[model samples]
Target: MQPIDKILRNYQSMIVSGAIILFCVIALIFAVIPSVQKIQEMFVQVSDIAAEAEGLQKKLNVLNALDEQTLRFQLASVLTAVPGDRSFPSLFETVEGVAARTGVVVQQMGLSGGTTLATPSAAKLSAADRKLGARTVPFSVTVNGSISAVQEFITLAPNVRRLLRIRTFAIAFPPDERPLTVSIEMDAFYEPLPTSLGTAKTILPELTAADNEIIERLGNMELITQSAEALPEPFIGQIKPNPFVP
Candidate 1:
């Protein structure tokens, strides 16, 4: 038997309470849910940054183990053995030294077309070819020596100051008391060293067993001059006069 007006007022309050509850649910769906998703995304990004930082720290640690000066010297030796320049005179001197050591006499030498001089065509090469980062310069040389001497020269080619790969070999046995005439075709490779990679970052994954073996082989090479005092002039004198100099 409650008054009708009082019952109506009570119903109004209930409706207001329900409206408030509904508004709160809508806010959670529209606002709070999106905020939670954003927080999760930020957490993922932070995790990625942490992983990247850890990887960089590992790389820095690897670089810390190297002796910068010694690495530079070793790398310089390797690159010098296979120079980026068209240093024909240095190549010739290297060959002559090897022949002398083997008691052989170089009778004739001829360079291939692309190997002798750089032309306009060199600039027009495709991007892929240019990006290969290495080029082969080929040449042919004839020498006169005993078979044993020629064998010794072949054995020693890998240990020479300049990197030369024997591509073709032929021999003509002259009559008795005459030395054997040996013909050799070789490929000299050239690859530029990036300046960004100094002695510390020059090599990655550190030098492996095979890499150390190669370093050992190059280190054993009997260069023309070892002393710092004797290195400059002899090296300067040996390289070809710059063809581009007008």
Candidate 2:
């Protein structure tokens, strides 16, 4: 053997140890480190999925506990009280019903602040009203009746199913013997329904005791107007061979 062979023989053990250490370092950089990072990423994904699943399970439990019929009734009562739109017809019906019940005649009626044909958009609402998530439609009614009848009308107007706020009123006493002419200015409230639903991870809101009490009160209130459209009749007969055929 030559001098180089002699040197290789002298440091063979040290060279082998260094080669092993270098191999381990390369593995750490190329494989083991990457594998550890991948494992961490998977753990994060699993955690997110678990949280989402828990949220979904909670939502499902709440939904399963709810009574559909009771919910529908409550919703109906609420919508009747504060309609999803202007509902001019229902408002008129409510006012007219109160007038008729109180032995009063509606001499004149006119809508103000918004068009009677279309629902007012949120952009048209004032900042305070928009913040409250409710819009008001102002209208004035002129009714002729006895003093007692007019007082009853005013008293019952706010308590009706269609919620109204009596902004102002004026009573006119004619020189001749005539019924009292009362001009009442009122505001009917409405809130538009949400156009979009929340994400799956969003939690459902729970109704509190106060909400239930309000719904109960609304349910007890008289509903003077009928639904604008009737519910579609349920299918009674057997299914046709071609189910797609109407």
Please give each candidate's TM-score: 0.74, 0.81
Global Cα lDDT for candidate 2: 0.82
Candidate 1 lDDT (Cα, 0 to 1): 0.71
lDDT of 1 by residue, 1-246 (tens): 568777878798888889999999999999999999999999999999998777777778877877878876776676567664545667777788788888989999889544335542343333433665556567888999998999998887656767788878999998798999999988665654332444432335668899988887877776642221111122222454874552
| Top candidate (TM-score) | 2
Error of 1 at 209 (Å): 2.9
Q: Which ranges of candidate 1 are over 4 A from the true structure?
A: 1-8, 116-134, 195-205, 224-246
Q: Write the per-residue lDDT of candidate 2 for residues 192-219, one digit (tens) a residue.
A: 7664556867778899999888889988
- Clash list (residue pairs), candidate 2: none
| Candidate 1's TM-score | 0.74
